[model samples]
Target: MVAREKLNQLKEKFGGAVQRADMPCNERLFVFVEASALKAVCQYLFRDLDARYVISIGMDDRPFSGKFMVAHDFAFDQDHLLCSVLTHLPADNPKVDSISDVVPAANWAEREIRDLVGIEPVGHRYLKRLVLPDGWPDGVHPLRKDFAWNQVPEGYDDTREFKFDEPPEGCTVVPFGPFHPTLDEPAHFRLYIEGEMVRGCEYRGFMVHRGIEKLAESVLTYNEIPMMAERICGICGCVHNVAYAQAVESAAAIKPPPRAEYIRTIMLEIERLHSHLLWVGLACHIVGFDTLFMQSWRIREPLMWIAEKISGNRKTYALCVIGGVRWDITAEVKGELRKVLDKLESEWTPVVAAVSKDKNIQKRTRGIGVADRALVKNAGLVGPVARSAGVNMDCRRDHPYAAYDRLDFDVITENGCDVWSRVLVRAKEVFESIKIIRQCLEKMEDGPLQLTIKDELPVGRIGLSSVEAPRGESHHFVITGENNRPRRWRVRAPTYQNLQAIPAMIKDQQLADMTISLGSIDPCFSCTDRMETIDLKSGATKVWTQEELLKLTRTKKT
Candidate 1:
């Protein structure tokens, strides 16, 4: 009765879009709310009930409903796992109110949503395209159901003629990517700066939109989509696959064997280790520590090798499938993992010590993008970014899935709430992940890795699954019970949550600090791009194009 009362309060406060509520196999109950109530519920969950923002995601809902869904994963005590606040908005309109006002971490999430899903966040102070080309079409949202796969929009082939030289008066706009020098991927950013500080910004992406969501609907079966989804992000591929499979399983109401759960957790932690290592390297590079970046990546080689050895592919390992995992680590591989963990533990000490003690790194990172605790909670941030801001949230610890509940590790947090704190949190989490892998190795029991789930999905059922990705939270929403595949599939990556907090973080920071501040969110632009609009009423124009405006000063010497 006492437990029920607590759950009831949560339901009462955030009820409108609460879709499905359930206790896990354990007795603790959690309710799923709408994305509209995300900020309110997160506040209720945290300030009032002491819950934490575990993670959030924005998924592409293709075909059937043709809507994009936002899922915010939250948690309370160790026992209770709040499923998510799941809300769906039209793929055409795509826009939703920005939650950054409430949770600072959401800045990046909103940016990515604009970048990938073409969602125009109403009132989002920094609604720039994050990951796509500079001259993407105005009304063609990429993740929408109707976006043509084979044909590129007419003007996309020749966007070189549409560059803008100077931004409007008092609004300092600077273009970022879509093939600039900053990043490997084709994500673009146009910063609106006020002197040395950033006033607001925009992000663009989707230069390489493979139409994975649309392809998933046409080509893949329910079982095959898991492997297909694994290719979404090369770094966090496994999490995408696992979360999608789990969502399918939840919709079907089928649980994998206990041993399979243990194996899944092991893979997840291994992936976590490699991801953190990769990010550490990137973080180093961002601060001009190329040697450290290379060294960290070198250490990550063993984990990648092990992943290939076990799952056949080095990057996109199709280890996870619906109903169960596709591969299992043999005793030999298990032994090798333990050896790798031991090696990483020994090697990481000096590496981390070097970074932590470096005066240069300290100068570059310390106090450089501070998001206070109030901003964090209000924005409802997630993952290490939130943890760095004193939000002790980790999906593995809070909303335990797979064998996370069985494993033991602390959710690392730091009060520093700066770029330095974020780096520290991720570094500590790598160690915690190592501990988890060791536990899984010791406790492994021989069992079948695969389960036979029917190809067809049942009708009228919706299942949401959330996983802590390297950046933050990745969510999969499956609304399909009929036919061979999901009728509606929505996938939300962590960038969706982190993108929202950018404007808040970069407001007063120097322009140079903008790079580091953006990196603090740990964004992924696998598929994001710029989108522009012209205000019909005012006749003032806002268009995202690379078109070069005529410079009056550069005009013929009159």
Candidate 2:
């Protein structure tokens, strides 16, 4: 169940290098390797074992282990094995050989760990600031346990600007955001353009980094973190809530009742339904198709109302607790949910058919923002983005958290590997979500909504959970501690990996199509920054009219 043969193979090859190996659950394997052998162990898992890199977490554990701790996570989607390769470095010399060269998706996580935990990623290509702001002072390392949550370092400069690399020869520099019509949050993009074609792009983002993880580890109690995790992403609040609860449950080895598991599954699917519909509408609006945008929104409004009716709030359901769910699907609510699913299916079928045949839609999307399987493997992309590229990996089917094991549904995939395929995948998945919810309603039995724990949860245990968010996989890693709080909590959002592939997708693309290319990912950032005006050196710097964008898109071929 824990891939015993593979674990033994690793032991056979790297016998002494594997300091400790554990099977925490049937699906998870935790291997603590010698600090010097970290790279080789990761390479074996990522390249030889064909495991997909999930995330890397850095923690200051000098107090407990007398050393710094780093965790490199990988997902063997085919074998359903989720592995964490952890290693500890000496407290005085807290450094580890970089694995980013072997696992490209580990690039940002390594840099982010360096930025927050003060553990240097030696040999990392871009070891500069990632999660921290440019104005943040050097050596401050806010995530270190010694630093207070609200503490501000001395000599901090709020007005400091990021310095990007020089643009290529014959290419003009075009700044995309800090203020752009398409991005909601304050992320700046430096686009090097030569005659309307994008040569390369450099991103300086994380303006939306709210320190949610810090809050959970420092101040929040065991039962309270679920509520805080929900605020991490506005669109996927329930996904965060559920992931956090499950991580705790996994660490404490707490099993909720069958009915609670079913409720969690139902809520997740409901969230997916609304999220996919919202994405369809937004993608349509990005392509200058206002009619479809309005239509999609019209069809989705009822879902928002239904969510509020059941969860007491529309977005932050706050439905998940440590051991189980806070709310259950009552008989009346179940009946209403079925009716809504029926109407959603009825309305979405015609829209999908019309969009599938629309020449304008196809031209705008067919060849744009393509992420091939090779790029996906390198960047460790997940969810629909990976599925669109013919990479068959779904956390629901592979990882099977919540009530997914008891349910039956297709893991929707597309071979097209383009924006068009991504759209189609989400559209078809709406029907699958409806199916999942219907099954939950039919097979779920009556039981308590939550479990009562007689004692405090065991401390110093590791917990990991990955939920299939509408955008992609949302993963949470937890380390339990004393005083009713987790000592360390790390969250890896889907955008953490998917956003890395943007430069690859947008390379050699027409400048006019940049908005749609970015929109295809459905970034959690706010609606584009209004740039009705721009500096004179760059002419015609205004959000394009619908007609112009569509015409520009059609002129370009795949």
On lDDT, the leading prediction is 2
What's the C-alpha lDDT at position 220 in model 1? 65
Question: Where does the lowest 10-residue lDDT sum fall in candidate 1?
Answer: 529-538
Worst 10 residues of 2 by lDDT: 527-536
Write candidate 1's Cα lDDT for 102-133 as tens digits.
Answer: 55455665665666566666677766554445
Which number leads on TM-score? 2
lDDT of 2: 0.86
TM-score of each predicted structure versus truth? 0.77, 0.93
lDDT of 2 by residue, 427-517 (tens): 9999999999999999999989999988999998999899999999988899998889998888888888888888998999999778788
Error of 1 at 177 (Å): 2.4
Q: Candidate 1: global Cα-lDDT? A: 0.70
Model 1 TM = 0.77
